[model samples]
Target: MSAPMPTGVHYHQRSRELALTYDINGESQSFRLGAEMLRVYSPSAEVRGHSPEQAVLQTGMKYVGLKNITPVGNYALKLHFDDGHDSGLYTYAYLWEMIENRELWWDDYLHELKKANASREPLGIPLQRQ
Candidate 1:
């Protein structure tokens, strides 16, 4: 079984780069989010809504990056993607969870790409603007 993530993380300002403090766990991690990465990993319904089969393929996000990280509360973070996406609020625990399982998550992403028979070349979120 995987080890449980330590419950301690505080999101700081939304700067070009982000620095987080995990007090209880005595661990800290800093990550520079690329705009393309944010867009592809968006948690919005546009990227993850409807059904698994209906999941839209994301492409052309290599140039996309994170512009800012807005704190929604003590528990969540609203990422402002360079592509102008600012909807998904990654919870503190959620981010930690992702970090803890980065490899698995990355594998899943690759699997998604293969399932869709797509490439990693910057793809836009499949949702259309109304």
Candidate 2:
């Protein structure tokens, strides 16, 4: 079966959410994706790496937000992050997978963080003692 095509895409600035609308199997569906979630799960080579063992852990993205989104052909989107990351090509299938498995994926991410003793909080600038 072919993937559902997105009928509309809207970014809510104040809420830092992306709304994707699609029609599938004669039903209309809308997905609200959070900016932080998208940033952490970016499909860029820098983030995902070439192998599962080489996947980079995304830290300090608790408050990350999207800056822009550009379409790459008819198959995917190039997301521009506020932190200057813009290499991930988010395909329709990937977006659907994320929507469907968000809970499982989030759990795994949290587990990895716990195992690594990592914090999602952004890094703070160190103060200079005079």
| Candidate topping lDDT | 2
Candidate 2 lDDT by residue in tens digits, 3-65: 676988988877878899998778888998888888889998899999988889998887677
Best of the candidates, TM-score: 2
CA RMSD of each candidate after superposition: 6.6, 4.6
RMSD of 2: 4.6
Give every collision pair in model 2: none
Residue 13 lDDT in model 1?
Answer: 26
TM-score against truth, every candidate:
0.65, 0.90
lDDT of each: 0.58, 0.85
Q: Model 2 residue 54 lDDT?
A: 82
Per-residue lDDT of 1-130 in model 1, one digit per residue for the tens? 3333333333232333344444445555454333444466667777867677655768655445556666675667788776677877776666666656666766787787888788876455553322
Off by over 4 Å in 2: 125-130
User: Deviation in angstroms for 88 in model 2?
Assistant: 0.7
